[model samples]
Target: MVFEKIVEILRNYKEEPELEVTMTSSFEELELDSLDTVELVMEIEEAFDTSIEMDGTLLTIGDVVGLIEKAIA
Candidate 1:
């Protein structure tokens, strides 16, 4: 459920509608810059209703999913 929501948020930033996304996909690979990352994080926080400490360590979709899982646990 979390992954699906994350993907939906990400799809807004993607140019290609058919682009493939997976847990291992990096923000860089997704063409999301630092600003985009910040925005994405904000959107995720709003959608999930939880705070996420923005950091340089988060690199992949799976990383974010894990954080959300932990945050709502």
Candidate 2:
């Protein structure tokens, strides 16, 4: 469910018409920059009513999703 939600968030900012979102999709392919990532993290925190302490290693969309899922679980 988190992955699906993440995909929806990605779709909101999808700049390229050809980009496809799936569970296996990479974050780099979404063209998300640092600001985007921060915004996304904030959105996720609000949506889930939780806080996520992220490190610099969350460089990809999938990594963020994975972290979210882990936090939720």
Candidate 3:
């Protein structure tokens, strides 16, 4: 369920017409900068009804999914 929501959020932000995303994809691979990460974190917080501390760590889609799973659980 969290994976699906993350995918939906990411899909909405695709700048190109044919960008493909996957679980192992990194934020750098997705072209997400600091500002984009800020926004994505906010959306994730709202979706999970929990808080996330950046600590300058999150790198991959899998990382975010893991955090979300922890928060939701």
Q: What is the C-alpha RMSD of each candidate to the true structure, in Å?
A: 1.2, 2.4, 1.8
User: Candidates ranked by TM-score, best first?
Assistant: 1, 3, 2
lDDT of 3 by residue, 1-73 (tens): 8887888777776645456767798888888988898888788778778986775788888888888889779
**Tens digits of lDDT, candidate 1, 1-73:** 9998889888865656667889999999998998989999899989999988789999998999999999999
Which residue pairs come into collision in candidate 3? none
Better of 1 and 3 by TM-score: 1
Off by over 4 Å in 2: 15-18
Question: What is the Cα-based TM-score of model 1?
Answer: 0.90
Flag the better candidate by lDDT, 1 or 3.
Answer: 1
Query: How do the predictions measure up, each by TM-score?
Result: 0.90, 0.72, 0.83
Give the clash count for model 2: 0
Best by TM-score: 1
Model 2: per-residue Cα lDDT over 1-73, one tens digit each: 8877766666665644455776555556667777777887788777777777866877666776777878788
